[model samples]
Target: MTSLASKLTVIVSAAFEEAGLPADLGLVRVSDRPDLAQFQCNGAMAAAKVAKKNPRAVAEEVAGRLKARGEFAKVEIAGPGFINIDLTPEAIAGHLSAMATDARLSVPEMAQGETVVLDYGGPNIAKPMHVGHLRAGIIGDTLRRIMAFAGYKTLGDVHMGDWGTHLGILFNDYIRSGEQDKVLKVDLDDPASVSALFEDMSERYPRASAASKEDEALRAQAQEATLKMQNREAPYYEMWQKVKAVSIVGMERNYGMLNVHFDLWKGEADVHDLIPPMVDDLKARGYAVESEGAIVVPVKRNEDKKEVPPLLLVKRDGAFIYGSTDLATVVERMQLYGPSKIIYVVDQRQGLHFEQVFRAARMGGIAPDAVELTFAGFGTMNGPDGKPFKTRAGGVLKLEDLIAMGVAKATERLNDANLAKDMPETERASIAHKVAVAAIKFADLQNQRQADYVFDIDRMVSFEGKTGPYLLYQAVRIKSLLRKAESSGSETRGFGNTEIQKFGDSDIPLALLLCELPDVFEGALNNYTPHLLCEYAYRLAQTFSSFYNSCHILSEEDEVLRGSRLTLCTLTLAQLELVLSLLGIEVPDRM
Candidate 1:
C-alpha cells in the first residue's frame, strides 16, 4: 500500500490539477505535526511564493476546489497556508487491517534483488575478543538481517585479521620462550597471567633481537627459524599449528555466545597470495607508484595531516600492508559474487582508508557504482576511572567475560522479579540466560551506531523504559492475554481485505495506533537505523497499554465490537512479535 501520507498527497495534487492551478509545486512531503491532523501538505505556500500570490488564498482556493471523496474526513487550512488532513476513521482502520493480512509488513520489495556484502565481527588472531568487537558484531548482524528481510542476498564475512606483524611477534615469542606447549592451553582471559606472559614475551623479543644482531651467527639462525615457521617447517610448523588451534577455539566460543555466524571466515592469510598480482595491476594501470622502494596508491593526501605520510601499499621490505589486503578482497568480491553493493561495519577511524580503497576500486573498473561503503563507529567501554576501557589492574577485557557479567546481572533481576515463580528452578535459569543475552544485544543496538555508548549492565538489563527486556516483557504480556482469550473460546472477527472499510462504532484510537506501523517501517528502512524500530516497539507497547486500559475487549457487550477488538489485540501482538524478532530480541513465553 502507498503510505497514508503518500495517498493523501496524491489526492491533494489531483485536486490542484482539477482547479487549473500549477500542478508542479515540485515534490511534497508529509509534515510532522500531530497536533493539527494525520497528514499536512506545505506545497501551497511554496507555490504561492513562486506565483507571487498570498499563501492563505492559494490554500483556501485549493481547499475549496477539493472534493471530500471519503479519503479524508476534512481538509482545513492551518498555519501559513498548510493543508492539515484529517483522515477518516474508516481509512485508518482499513490501512491497519491491510497490514495484518499482508506478509511484507507493508514494506515494498526491491525492484530486483541486489547482492551485498557486510564485513563485521573483526577479531584479530592472538588478540583477545573484547567489547570493542561487540558493536560491530551486533550492528552488522542486524544490518544483514534487515537487508535479507528486504530480500537482498547478503554475505556476512568476519574479515579476520589473522595475518600481520602481530602474528610474527607472537610466533617469535613462542619460539624463544620454549612455551610452545603452553600456547596450546593458555586461557586468554586470565588477565593477570596473560598480561604477564605477553609483556614478558614482548620484552624478551627485542632483547633477543639486539643480542642476535651483535652475534651474526645467532641472527642468521633466528632468521632461518622464522623462515621455517613461515614455510611450515618441521618443529616450528607444529608450534604454529598449536597457537592457531587455541586462538580459533577461543574465537568460536565467543561467536557461539553472541549468536553470530559468518558466511565466510576467510582471513588476510587466506588472501595473502592474491595481493601481488593486484599490486602489479595497479602499477600497470598507473594507479600506483614507487616511493622509497615501496608501492603506494597515489591518491591525494589529506591536508589535515600535513606531517603524516601517504598510504603505503607495500613496505620497503616488500611486505604487504592491510590496505593491499583490503584492495585484493574488494577485487575478489567483485569477481566472485559480482555484488552491486558492499557495506563495511568498520570504525569511523578507518573512513579515510575505505575512501582510498573505494577510489582505487573505481579506477580498477570493478563497478563504478558497484561498491557502496559504510563505516559504523563504535564507543569504548570505560571502567570507573573513565579512561579508555580497561580492567582495574589495567589490562584489556575479554568479550566472553563481559557477556558473562551481563548474564549474571540479568539473572539477578529475573530472580528478583519472580517472573516464573511456579516454574521448575532449572527451566527458570535457562530462560533467564537467553533473556540476559538478548538484553545485551538489544542495549547495544537500541542506539544510533555513530554515538558512543557506555556498557552499564544496570542500565541495560532494567525492565523499564527503552530497553530490550522491556520489549520482551510487552511481548510476553500480549502472549498471556492471547492465551487467556483462546482458552475461553473467544471468537475473533478480523477486519476484512477491503482497503477502505469502515471501523463501525469501535473506538478509533486502537485503529489509529495500528496505522502507524507502515510509517515506522518506512523510516527504519530508508534511514538505515534500527533505533527507529526500537521507537516503534516503544510506541506499540504504549498503544497496547492504552488500548487495554480504555477499552475492554473481553467484556464488551456487543459481540461484533468485542470480536473485532479482540482481533485487533491479537493482530497487534503478532506485529509486536515480528518487530521484536526483526530487532533480534527474543521474548520468553512467561516473561
Candidate 2:
C-alpha cells in the first residue's frame, strides 16, 4: 500500500544516484502546477547548486534515466530544470485499486508504538463548564483520535480543577452558611440530593469567590481552608471529597453530551500528595529557592529575549499553587505512563505559564530530556463582536446551553430542508444530535488551533459550503448512490479491478487526490493541525461532486466504465468517512 508519491520518490531517488548526484535530492512531491504534470521534483536545482552544474543539464540527465525506467507516461524537464512527471493511466489505476482494499486507506502508522498523554478539558469542580471550554474538549479529543489512528498509544486526561482555592472559598462559605452538616449527612447515592448540594455550592461559590477578593479576613480564611484541605484535615477533606463526587456527576453529564470522553478522570487532587516531595526535591537539588518568602524555580536563561519570571511553587502561607500541581502531574505521568510526549491543549494566553513549567520540569530533572513537553495552545472562540462569546446578559454561556442551541438550530435546518421528515421521531432526534455535534466540532476544528474563530451556529449547521453538515450531506449522497446501484443489481465488484477503461477529466483528479490522503494525515499529525485534514476533506467532497456530475454511473451502458466510476465513488466515501471520524465527527447514514 505504498503511496504513488513514495514509489515515485524511490524511483527518482535511485535516478539521482545513477546520475552521480546525492540520492536525497530525488524527493518528489505532488506538483504545485497541476496543469503541467502529476508530480514534480525540484531536486535537480539543488543538486546543480551543490555540484556547480546547470540545473537543466542535471534535470536532463535524471530525466533520461527516468524515461528509460518507463514508469511514468511522460517525464520532461520544465522551466529551469524542474522535473515534471505524469504517471501512466495504468499506474494510477493500480494505486487506486490497492487503496480501495486497504483498511487504513494507505495511511501508514507513523507513530507506531509511541505513547502520548493529552491534557485538556480543564473544568473546575462545583463550577459548570462554559463555552470557553469548548475548543479544548473538541480539539483535544480530535488530536487523541488522530494520534491513536497514527498508531500512538494516547491517554487523554480531563484534568479537572477540583483541588484549588475556589474549592476553599466554597468550603468557607458553606461552613459559615451552616450547610456543612446537611452536605455531610446527605447520601452520595441519591442523585437528587447530590444535585441539589452541587447546585447550592455552585451558587454560593460565586458569591464567596467575589467576597474573597474584597474581604481580607474571608480571603485569609479561604487560604487557611485551602491549606487545611491540602493537609487532609477534619471535615474539610471529607467535605472536599463530597463536593468532588457531586461535581463529577455534572461534569460527566455535560462532557457526555459533547461525546468528549477522557481516559483518565484525574485532577490536581491526584497530584497533591506528590507536590510536597517534589518541592522538597527541587529545593534540595538547588532548582528551587525562596524568592521574597515564596519558593520559586528560577527559569530565566541568559538567551531569553523577554522576561521569564520564576515559577512559583509554594506561597508563604504554605499552600501550593498551580505550578506545583502541574509539575507534580508531569512527574506522576512520567513515572506511571512513561509517555514519550505530553501535550497540553490549553488557551494561548497561558503560553508563558507553560513555558516556565516546562523549563522548571527539565531544570529540576523531574522530566527527562527525551520526553517532549509541548503546549498546544489555542485562541479564544469569539462572538461576532470579536470578543469572547458570552450570553446576552454578558454572562459566560454554559457548555450545555451552547450545545442545546446547536441542536435546536440543527433540528430547524432539518425541518427547513424537509430532510428526515418521514423517519421515526427517535431516529430524527438522533440525527439532529449528531448534526449538532458535527457542526460544533467541525466549526472549532476547521480552524488552525492557535487562531481565533467566531462561533456561528447558523453558518456551521448549513447544508452547503465548508460546513460539517455539508460534508455529512455529501457522504450521505454517496451512500444513497451506492444503495441505488445495489438495488439495480450493480454489484460493487470493481473495487479490485485495476483496468479502468479510460480516465475522464474529473476521474484522474479524484484518483490523484485520493493518493494524497496519507500525506494529508501525516501533515496534520506532524504539525498537530486538524485544519489541514479539514481542508482536504472539503476539497475531496467538492471534487467528488464534480466527478459525479460529469460521470453517469447507473445509466452508463458500458459496464466497465460504470463499474470503474462506482468504485471511485465507493472509495471516495470511505476516505471521506475516515477523515470525518478522525475529526471526531460522526456522519449519519442520511441527512
In order, the Cα lDDT scores of the candidates are 0.68, 0.87
TM-score of each: 0.85, 0.95
lDDT of 2 at 270: 98
- What lDDT does candidate 2 reach at residue 397? 77
Best by lDDT: 2
Candidate 2 similarity to native, TM-score: 0.95
lDDT of 1 at 318: 61
User: Per-residue lDDT for 482 in model 1?
Assistant: 71
The RMSD of every model to the true structure, in order and in angstroms, is 5.0, 2.1
lDDT of 2 by residue, 1-591 (tens): 567888789999999998899999999999999999999999999997899999999999999999986468999998989999999887888888788778898998887678999998899988877888888988898889999999999999999997889988988888888778766776789988987887787667788999999999999999999989888997899998888888888889888888887999999999988998998899999999998999999999999999999999999998989999999999999999999999999999999999999999999887889998989999988888888877678777787877788788878777776666787878788888888888787778889999988876466555457888878888989999988887877764443353455566669999899899988898889888998999999999999988888877778777777778887888899999999999888888887
Shift of residue 515 alpha carbon in model 1, Å: 2.8
Question: Can you give the lDDT of residue 66 in candidate 2?
Answer: 92
The residue pairs found clashing in candidate 1 are none
